[model samples]
Target: MGYSPSVHKFAEGADVPVPLDLELVRAVLEPHDVGDPRLCFDPDGDLQFWIRAGDGSEAEIFAGDTGILVERPHSGGVFGIVAELVSRLGAVAVDPSEGRIVCSTEEYAHLPVSMRKDAVVIEMTGERLEAALLGRRPA
Candidate 1:
């Protein structure tokens, strides 16, 4: 719903603030067409949150203690929302498919072609890291 169809934040996991500030993300997103965010879970029940877009569909913004993963197919005039979030959150826009961290849409026309394919692995890796930090088992 933004410049890129899919964007992975916290490309560099070590750089995030410990006890990640959930409010910081809320603040950055509140001004947009999205509504309030609330705790959400998949059928598998991995912890995350969801924000409802104006269209009443869930926005792809996935918030975790360590990173945020967003993947969307439709464009709802939410352009540049991702850029602002990245800027305000100090989160890196990593396109592993491109083998680089993308800072702006101008850097390339294609942001990620393989992220959807690789997200499960990347997220699983993050789960281990998060589990270590929280002193808990990864679900």
Candidate 2:
């Protein structure tokens, strides 16, 4: 089974956190129309949808106020698309499988990070990555 990776949202050009929701993702992708964002509604705070790649392959997007999760990404181009997608949202794509930020080497160098037990910790919260997503460790 393919694992899910997630994006961390922050203020534009800044490290301050921001809300990540379906509306924000829709707004970022509406004009480009690069992929079809399936629309649905739920009173629950979280939602999921399909994000297609240029090659017609797709992945699932789980979006909520806390964060966005992407799974079963089969296309190479999806990473490129994701980079652009997150950039538009002032966020970063993190690959939990790789335990590193999905970014260029130079960009990765500048991220505020710490290594703990071979785990990459985002200094933003000093949290360990869980299921390829950043999560705070139990206190």
Candidate 3:
């Protein structure tokens, strides 16, 4: 009964540009009353943060060159908060449940056709994540 979040990165290198403004992202998400915002970096060099939502739900967010990855609880308005964050940051939400993508930013329209058709499926492995981001069937 929860939702999974993922980001689409089109570039394949170490110098990918991060699309989100961390300051602004923090400002917008602050209203959600996030607690213990621990900032860190992923192995891929993505900026990441872990926070506890107002409702005590834990979430992890990773800001990367391609887009932002958000993992939040599905309850207690987490979905609404995610939508607002995506809109403010000019990102998109992939709805695996609906087998479609929810575009929240203008950039969504400019994304490549391959990305446009990408669906977000929840999986725990790196290969699955790679496949999902690449718009390819998971092997």
Give the count of colliding residue pairs in each prediction.
0, 0, 0
Candidate number that wins on TM-score, 1 or 3: 3
Tens digits of lDDT, candidate 1, 52-80:
44544444666656566665413332324
Which residue pairs show collisions in model 3? none
Candidate 2 residue lDDT tens string, 1-139: 6867878654433444467656777665444343334453345746656656566656666667757777776544454455565655655567756655543333344344442223343322111223224332523
| Candidate 3 lDDT over residue span 1-139, tens digit each | 5456654432222233346566766676655544454446557766666655555655667666666766654443354455566656655555445545555335445555666555343332333433443355655
Each prediction's whole-model lDDT (CA): 0.43, 0.53, 0.53
Give Cα distance to truth, residue 79, candidate 2, Å.
3.0
TM-score of 3: 0.53
Please give the ranking of all candidate structures by lDDT, highest first, separated by commas. 2, 3, 1
**How should the candidates be ordered by TM-score, best one leading?**
2, 3, 1
Candidate 2 — which residues are off by over 4 angstroms?
10-17, 30-39, 104-139
Off by over 4 Å in 3: 1-3, 8-18, 37-47, 51-58, 95-100, 104-108, 117-139
Give the Å shift of residue 120 in candidate 2: 11
Candidate 1's TM-score reads 0.44
For model 1, the local distance difference test gives 0.43
